[model samples]
Target: MMNVLSAQDKQRWRQDGYLVLPGFFEQAATEEMLGRARQLLDEFDVEGHPLTTFKTEADGEHVGDDYFIGSNDKIRYFLEPSSLSKPAPGAPSKLLVPPAQSINKIGHALAQLDPVFRKYTLENEKVANVAKDLGYHQSPRVLQSMIICKQPRIGGVVPSHNDSTFLYTDPPSAVGCWIALEECTPQNGCLSFLPGSHKTARVSSRFVKDPSGRGTTFESVAGVEPNEEKWDELDGWVEAACPAGTLVLIHGNVMHRSPPNPSDKSRLIYTFHMIEGAEGYTYDEKNWLQPTKDMPFPALF
Candidate 1:
């Protein structure tokens, strides 16, 4: 059973940019979560759903009004790029298949909106202890959470990138906790990591939205350039296959990627980002997702 991070484990995380906790959550819990996930997916009403699907212009940022702009706090479905149609000029984005099989992820925020996830991430004190042991020191904030549905056959390649790039802080404090609900294996596109990358990896650009919240884009921050090619040349990237109920703690700046799942099995996983909630460190306003004023990302203490 997984417990608090030992000193050796902490050292490994500090030096290697990650630590894997096998069976951190009990098997029964994982099974329950998986069941709930499927139940929610089946229960989601999709009849002429206005925002049931979302997409970015090929190689472009997300574009929309309040209905889309405000998706940050709401539970919603985001479509994978492989499932949407490429429009020419004035045509609406078309769905290539049934909406259920095409979803990339379920959320901008599911932890606060859903009780099953809330129990695992927020109500569990052991997890809070894990976060403290990982060096958050104080109460860590559950900044963002998602149920990544690496849908069978069409799960798009998650490009080589870092968590800090997306959930950047002023001093760059972002930690990712990824849990595999299903068996994550090579055939299903398990996450690949560049070992010891946090020692030198830097936050290059961040996904952001305009102040008016019209369009989402990437803005560069003060950091190092992309060195994926160099890292690959040195054979640094390693595939991390996680079993069900395993928790993988990932540093903010470690370069990682997962290949597209071309297999018949879906690589379903639940993940969330935690950031240092202490003074002086600030989450950039430019970061696209923001919680509602009434229901801000909670403190995990």
Candidate 2:
């Protein structure tokens, strides 16, 4: 494979824990993705809503009733009729929606066509390579999409935390590519990351409930001591203000979070994970672990 990442870019990713790749997609691709997303929302009768988060039917309730209350019609479109009436197989009370296989299929195709997605999926091989360098060989994993449509005066904040907490994998060989489908600014709750925080030796296992109240935070697992200076230095965290089509590649272990989208305009973004393949790696099927054995690796463009 051709080396898409420069030496400096790799170094920066290793040291800073993330990289900002500007113009990762052309205008046409960006517009297309946004269009497809809108069409999907329309197909599901999801419009004029506050916020939307998509999860498998098995995990739907964990996503909360707030996402489904006013948008029942939309929710029904994505979920099977049986799912709405009966609970998912494993999680009855949780209201988990079975995996939206169709949505995943569409998203996978879009990822191949979108420039920003292609760049991260194809050009940015550094993440997997780095894991190999570190002695892990796992393939890429596509987790889930987090789509948000912030209604006027209805947005909320997402506290700062590392993604590593939610994902459990040996050797920690996963990276996520977050692409902005709309203009993201500080006012719109753009993502913020703690530069180079992935290299930290500690791994916390705190259980911080997500909006759905089922997820846990990793900050408690690592048990990292707070350093005022380090916090202050990272406090100068940069907000990724990019036009649609900008791709932000971040380490799985990096500390990151986003505020609420205060703007009326929706902030659309998709996140995908990739890993290097090797033996002796174990995955937790019971827990939502990234790069699981059953989940297919993200397609390399």
Candidate 3:
């Protein structure tokens, strides 16, 4: 494995809670991943798809269902909320565009199901090398891989949140690797991060299955108020504007979000989260996404 993280890179990760490495992957590789994502989107059979719209607002109804919960080990498609027509009273909602163009993301287990995605993710030694450089002292397991399709003009906003809230561990050791498959600009809903927020912010809540086991809800962790920490504040936030093939490493506690895409161009990106999997750390069984015995989380090493 190659030592891609230099002294400066480590410094940036420590100070800013994130690192944007330009040209981390070649153009050809990114284009290939982008092409594969588009092909998967185009080939998706939406005829029977529940057309579940994806949203990340803590106050809004989260995207969850059998289709979503079962996606832990499968590649599933999710629709963009803005691309759907409002349903009339007692009527079902309809998609305003083609299935291929109406998607918000295809996610949760792309690396495990898709050969192409697997090649860039788990099969890539660079990913493991980077995790090692970041000092994942105990054990690191990759999970929750997705291709975020910031579709043309209807891509929805993702409210500021931390990865640990979703993929929680005992000590909250989740790191996200966000790779730009297409050019990410402000017009197309590029990510914005609150610099150093990881060091300051606390993972006080988690998205877990409800007691009924029918749906999910955000519960305060250890009696901490989930709303006490404000993520809406934009002061000192930096826009992560990068070209294709760029890789952005995000700390688990960093406050980050993206605006809606109102531009004609789409901002496509592949992202995955890694969590500490050592014996001491507990991966809550009540968590919305659970690993099956047959397809457990793969070690980063």
**Model 1 per-residue lDDT tens digits across residues 46-119:** 55555434443322545444555576788776667777788989876777867777777787677888899988
lDDT of predicted model 3: 0.87
Of 2 and 3, the candidate ahead on TM-score is: 3
Q: Scored by CA lDDT, what does every candidate get?
A: 0.78, 0.51, 0.87
- Candidate 1 weakest ten by summed lDDT: 51-60
Ordered from best to worst TM-score, the candidate numbers read 3, 1, 2
TM-score of each: 0.89, 0.62, 0.96
lDDT of 2 at 207: 23
Candidate 3 residue runs with Cα over 4 Å from true position: 223-229
Candidate 1: give the clashing pairs.
none
Q: What's the CA error at residue 300 for candidate 3, in Å? A: 1.4
Candidate 2 lowest-lDDT run of ten: 72-81
Q: Candidate 2 versus the native: TM-score?
A: 0.62
